[model samples]
Target: ELHLHTDHLNLTCSTFHDVHMIRWRLAIEEFGPTFHSVPGSSNVVADALSRLPITDEELEENPTVTMAAVEAAMSGEFTVDMRVIAAEQKNDKDIGESEEREIAGVLVLVHPKSKKILVPTRLRLRLVQNYHDLLLHPGAATMVITIGQVFYSRGIEPDERKLTDNYLACLKAKHPATRYGKLPPKSVEVCPWFEIADDLIGPYGRKRFRALTIIDTATRLIEILPATDATSMEAAYLMDRYWFARYPRPTRCIHDGGSEFKREFAELQDNYGVERVATMTRNHQANSVIERVHRVIVEKIRTKSINTQDEWANFLNDTMFAMRASNHSMLKVHRLSWHSDVTCWWALPTKQIGKRSINAR
Candidate 1:
């Protein structure tokens, strides 16, 4: 019966003239005969034939995930609420509730869910500082892993490229000064006095808040003078009290040609024997260090202030401490200390200010 069926199929094809046999087609069949005699690696037909098709059922039974995906999933699984963890971490009782919430928000975005999220006290402080203070913010994957290494017992890798792309998207609406660029190599050390000076603006409750920022060009150290109106007199006074009082007179100061940095501010710098070097008009890159630091400050304020009673003014000291104690990427050192061990210094550093300072209010 099988032989008859085969003959019938051949008859059907021949009768319909649908199957045409070319003499050249036999050449392919001849090569097939020699496949086994050739090396498997070199035998293209043999190699192709050797591969068994993987069924959809097999794929469904075992899903393959990459290292980056695994880390991202883990980050979502392990989260710690800083409010509950702060006291145990020996953090200042008044570490700014808004700041804690802001930090929590940041950590949560990186880690959405957690299997066993630990609310480590001291460990939390270390992780937060090391991630932010020890180094500049990393991509989502590294940030997750770096924080996870200290807190989670498991891997916490996120999709680094995706996270980075999202972060860049956040900056899309920022001022031109906040755009990304390659940092220039430092030619000279920026001392306490001689540094880049600028002002950043952010939302505080219903009103707008402005901060005077000075950053060491060489070390990437940041100092937040105070929250005040972005006026020349306020800038000069804050610089005199918070800046010049502790640090030696700066050799020079670099700033954008903003009106607030002109007029009285320029005269004030000259009076103190500090040369006023302004960047080319509208060129923020000339003072890129401070410009970058300003973004950080604004983000920090935005994080802590949203839906919280804490105003940006209240958290300036804490924010400044975090920035100063945090590690700088370019200088490869902590602005506040050169020592590897600077423990709990951020809890309450020198010149501790009230939650509401007279200048800020």
Candidate 2:
């Protein structure tokens, strides 16, 4: 019996799935040789023969074979025809009379200012996909900048955005560009002060004074009261003096779940028959109405008390006045003006019809 030792495991197997391997096995089996497995290190002669380099004389003698091997290696690669790209650029209205340049023996259109090669309309998407895959799928802005560094195309940014938006792999890996959930239902209030939102602004300035900010959801009227601390007692006292006493008690009072809004402050709401709606933990959007106003108030205080930060409480009245006078984006009227309409109705002692008495105080 003839024994053949080799490193190739597939050659040792008598059963073959491939057509060529089966034919090879049948021809070798006719000789009735026993196949033996050996380690690659032990098969030095076969390994050396497989890795043998061709001589210059042998390559010169077999030019056709060398050309066929090169063609086989490049069969799977994508190649752009510069002539076709140049022809398409002339027809593309968006490209509109761009300068042409000969790059690497190929005529191509180029951006006038940047002097980078301009990709044609037909290949723009394909070019973006290739670069995106090469870069392991980056964000749209990154891909746009990277591609723009070497190559350019008109409306590339939008094209890249569209391509990435539809890519399934990217969709799975990246967070959505827009907010996910549906918008929260809007709270509807028929009368001014029916629903109000309240929040505490600070611990700002050297005095560490905190302010209770209350806003009427219907009229957009804002009321601010400065205090030494943010305790429940102080919050309740400030609200009673500045908010509860000044306006009708809001049916629903929305606020954050701060320590200052518990115990005494909650009891104050119960006493007035006002429903206290505390926002979810760490979720400020539940009380966004008053939260948005916090930014404006802080900005105003910063501007007014630039030198002496301890005097921030002194600017509370001025900040409230400015906010009241400014046009409300949602209401489309001054907050004070909208509130004056309700105040006038309350002023009239009798329900008898009389001359209008709206004042912007």
Candidate 2: misplaced stretches above 4 Å?
1-187, 306-310, 343-361
List the candidates' TM-scores in order.
0.46, 0.43
lDDT (Cα, 0-100) at 75 in candidate 1: 26
lDDT string, candidate 2, 1-361, tens digits: 4688988899998666895675466545533567899999899998888799989888667643210111111122334556766777777777777788997787778989998987777778777676554433456766676667667877677889998788665654443432221225864434556788888877663345678898887567888877768899998998888888888777899988889999999999999999989985334346767756774554334333222334445457656765665444454445565555655545443212222222323
Model 1 off-target regions past 4 Å?
1-179, 182-194, 200-205, 306-310, 339-361
- For candidate 1, the TM-score is 0.46
| Residue 250, candidate 1: alpha-carbon lDDT | 65
Give the distance in Å from residue 126's predicted Cα in candidate 2 to where it truly belongs: 60
Error of 1 at 237 (Å): 0.7
lDDT of 1 by residue, 256-301 (tens): 7777777777778888888888775444446666766765664444
